[model samples]
Target: MGWFLGLGIAGLVVLALSLVFDGVLEGVGGGLDGLLSLPVIAGFVSALGFTGALATGAAGAGAVLATLAGIAAGTLAGWATWSFSRALLRDGAPAPRGEDLTGTSGAVVTAIPAGGYGEVLLHLAGQPVKYAAKAAAPVARGAEVWVESVLSPTSVTVRPVER
Candidate 1:
């Protein structure tokens, strides 16, 4: 019982150290492909020690039986920790690009002369942004326009909206 408690305490100390020095041991396995991350090891050790103590103290199990139970619990804890960490590290949606502005609608901020450039207030990624605009025909300030194509990183070709 005394040894089991000591092991449990040691496991907790290792877990604390892992949190404080995160990524330090990430390359320890060299070729394991992140299977031996600090969090996974910490979870395994902590679960093993605590479960062993519980099995022995609460269930009155012998040392061998308690150890077996602890190993099973530790493996499960390690696998779950690995899965959760991988899920969090996975890539998310790609960022919005200037090309995505084509076909979107906006309002002309500066009156556009035919065959010239003006400014339009457009929404890119749901946020208002101003961009240089060109049209085949003159457009008045505050008139709604539809983007026809993106000409550059900061410019677009547009047509006045009918409605």
Candidate 2:
């Protein structure tokens, strides 16, 4: 009973530290898989063991049986929690669409000769993205431009801005 309690307390301390520190257990495993993780597994086993032992009056064989049962239950619960969290946090956001560039203002990164490809930088999702660009007329580097159309996933057609 004392051992189980001590183990549980230690495991909880480790778990708390791991939460505060990003790389507390990076070498232990590549990622946290809940109960499969060392700290989580230890915490589950100790918590369950102590509770089971206490409920069984801390007796001999009954205490052992209860501890084993607790470990099993904790493991299942931990696994379920981990899986649910992973699913809930899954990145379901779609990638930026090419059509999103239509009418957006940008600047030429490379000079675009008439009917030829160069490069233009546009702000999309708050970040600069360079795209292959072609202009109806020659556009020099640093010239202001606007996306006229999306030619492909990685290319676009632009027109020089009047200003």
Candidate 3:
């Protein structure tokens, strides 16, 4: 009982921490997966061996308390892993940030069709750029392409290229 309770408390603390660490506003998936590790957390706590001893310490009142705490801790760890994986790893094609067409590889989303309006995919940069690009041919939105030429501040011209 006591063991389960204590373990439970630990679990809840860890779970809550994981949630706050990888909240939605943080941008679903980029590189934050390294924070929470269930095995690491649980194994570390279990190593103390206090939980086991507490649960089975005396086979009397002590046993009941210890069992409770151990269960609590285990539950918390499970919850943490579940929450972190869901919030941080949402799957979606990463889109370009700004008009930064520098050193990136993306396909023309809106075919330049002409010049005033063409789309190119550059590896999304930290800061997104706001510019238009031109391409020789129509750069299909999903076409595999790269930034060929950067015209101006918010303007870039791109063409197809091999990966």
User: lDDT of each prediction vs. the true structure?
Assistant: 0.89, 0.75, 0.55
Q: Give TM-scores for every candidate, taking all chains together and pairing residue i with residue i.
A: 0.60, 0.54, 0.36
Q: What value does the lDDT take at residue 116 in candidate 3? A: 57
Best by TM-score: 1
Q: Which candidate would rank higher by TM-score, 1 or 3? A: 1
> Where does the lowest 10-residue lDDT sum fall in candidate 2?
30-39
Give the C-alpha lDDT of model 3.
0.55
Model 2 global lDDT (CA atoms, 0 to 1): 0.75
lDDT of 3 at 15: 47
Which rank order by TM-score, best down to worst? 1, 2, 3
After superposition, the stretches of candidate 2 with alpha carbons farther than 4 Å from their true spots are 1-80, 124-127
Residues 1-163 of candidate 2 have per-residue lDDT tens digits of 5665665676677567656663445466645444355445545655675566565664554656867766776676556655665677587987788899999999999999998999999988779999999988999999999998999989999999994
Instruction: Note the clash tally of each candidate.
Output: 0, 0, 39
What TM-score does candidate 2 reach?
Answer: 0.54
- On residues 55-150, what C-alpha lDDT tens digit does candidate 3 reach at each position? 565454455565566556545654665566666667665865444465566656666685457645455445444346777776666777667567
- At residue 163, give the lDDT of candidate 1: 58
